[model samples]
Target: MFRSSALLSLLLLAIGGYATPVVREPSPVKLPFAVRFNNGTNGALNIIEADRARINLIKEQGAALAEKHENVHKRASYSVSVTNEAVTYIASIGVGSPATSYDLIIDTGSSNTWVGAGKSYVKTSTSSSTGKSVSVSYGSGSFSGTEYTDTVTISSNLVITKQSIGVASRSSGFSGVDGILGIGPTVLTEGTLSGSSTTEIPTVTDNLYSQGTISTAAVGVYFAPTTVEETTNGELTFGGADTSKYTGTLSYVSLTSTSPAKYYWGINQSIKYGSTSILSSTAGIVDTGTTLIYIATDAYNKYKSATGATLDSATGLLRITTSQYNSLSNLVFTIGSKTYTLTPNAQIWPRSLNSYIGGSSSYVYLVVNDIGSNTGSGLDFIDGYTFLERFYTVYDTTNSRFGIATTAQTTATTN
Candidate 1:
């Protein structure tokens, strides 16, 4: 069944490989999106507008999950590379033998790789039609197309032969990019094909592991907190965790058993405002596609009250004065046995980029917001980029565990 969320999405792509996969460090590649400032870059996101879009997007994702079982099972399109357009991260990849290069979005939310949002998918000597139609609908975008198995290459050492790829016959909601490189769970591929309802297509990460491209059937994600409009500050390590990317001990948490949330890289975690438990452990997903930290409505209310923040319609984020900022406490997340902290400085949007998000230079906006629902709704919260930028995340499909660790950005006061 298909579930969706809106706004702020990009698909990721990589080099395709067909050889016996080797266990090498699959380092994360830099997206074209510049974390630069003072330029009309990063899709020039107006904070207020982006916040509103993101709110609706997250709600769509949550609601879509709720309606999943009622609807016919369907898979969504794969990840796209992120871009400089404040809302996305992008990657450049090749399709076809003579390798037609394309820039794609990076997505972790959905899995089903395809192309032709901007540039069309080129059929090469390696292309072979699977004779099955494919379709997926993201909240902000959707695509319908034919399936093809082709020689995919990620790098010199990484390549997958006969990888299933969607050649979009129709698509929407993508600009300046091609399509997604979905590395989501293999199960998501279920019901994506027109006639092959029971078939499960392995993801890029899956191919890397099943074919021995990496040591483990896992992917490690690292994104740095950025003040600039763009930065190649992110890394994706295939197979195993990169000890150099993190500090202290890496804590592993099991995927939440909750429906819908469990469909993705979901987990059970509790939130605390310093010493007080604002939201007890609940089912939620960690989405690289999402942009902010979102809690259930009740938890949001408690958090807002605790922080003395007022809603700012202009930015779709909570607003606080300098005094409130000074009084902000450490917002802690208890996952597994480890406690990850989002310090006071980490809560507010960077003062330097307030105008970009359509806020006053003098005022500060909180990155934490409402998910449009309350706790116990199966899925409760989303630890988006705001949270990921501070911590490194590893998705281990083989072991069914999600790992998190502290990064340099964890203690950064950049915002």
Candidate 2:
């Protein structure tokens, strides 16, 4: 079972909780090896060097544009704090005046940091969500906030120069989440907030780069999951890769528009535990947003029966017998010519419930924790953490395929 509320609170503020004090540079931690993946069809592996070069190209482009304004490629890490169930701001972004902290989510799956608002939402022009009063909801809940354009600063590191951010009244039900910080390329863009009305908005990336915070057009993000542990064991370094966070090499799987973003490797024909095949499916999404691996019903049942675990309805989590949990061998998923093996913790997640049950075959609900008590579709799933922990995913949406590589692999140039 998991810890109590005290532990949970501590965990939230541990790594991903409060934005840490801003650092002047990306973490110098170097992982054990380079991360890359096979293209899945020809058995050609796409290493990190070339892909990194491309990503670097984009960063350089951003930086070049920034140099014209005497901008420096300054990046830092800041702690995000939730006060009174609401996030408070500490850094100041200098717009036409001083920029105040607003609520925001630091997301890697997304590429932009935007606030919800429009021209009419704010009485002042220095709002991320200005003139824009909208009700936005996530898988978590809903919040009402205005969007305005302002400068957002983290630890003296400028985020957006004149970016749009969402400013909400203390009454919004965000339950502590401030704004959405997207790290994906296309996912980040300027837009209008929608509710009863709409208004124009700018992304933090656009705002910051346009201003003089960092010289690069793109910013990097380092994030650790919100768990009940306060270890600096996890971090996402923007503009550079930190090598020490993981033991093995980094692997990659591409992201696509499909359900489970595509990987460089093909659908794992089937997963294997020694000689037995566990589950076979052609769909899976490599999401940085999720923390667990969700397998379909067929896969979930196979794992349950083979692992001899039981499902608890109260918590909607699966529990394997202590002996069963420890005795399980490594499980592997074969995608094209590549095979991914997972550790025990990667397969079986810790539960927070004391007791209750059905058989283990029913506990595959992936989203909303235990949100699948009465639904059938929820039983088949996998969260992103389990897989990402085992493999470095290379998302190549441009080519319609993703890549997967073992932690021992390194990124190399193809040509």
Cα shift from native, residue 189, model 1 (Å): 2.2
Which 10-residue span in candidate 1 carries the lowest summed lDDT?
1-10
Q: Write the per-residue lDDT of candidate 1 for residues 1-415, one digit (tens) a residue.
A: 0111111111223344657433344443322332222222343454333333434443445445545644734333223322222356666657778678666666787789899888888888999998889997665567899999887765545567778889998987666668888887776777789986567888888876766556677777877787755456666666677778799998898898886678788999999998989999888889887777889999999999999899987767899999889999999999998899999988888788777776797788999988777888676888888899899888999899999999888999998
Whole-model lDDT per candidate: 0.73, 0.36
Which candidate leads the pack in lDDT?
1
lDDT of 2 by residue, 1-415 (tens): 1111110000001122346543233323222111111121133211122222222222233333233334545222222221121111111122324544443444333343444321112234444334755443322223455555565544343344555555544232233333455444442221226542213234454443334332333432222222222222233332323344334544443332221122111233346665577555454334444444545555656666766666654434555565675686667776655666665544553232111112234233221122121212212233354355444444333343444544431221110
TM-score each candidate. Answer: 0.84, 0.54
Best-performing candidate as measured by TM-score: 1
- Model 1, residue 275: distance off in Å is 1.3
Candidate 2, residue 281: the lDDT equals 43
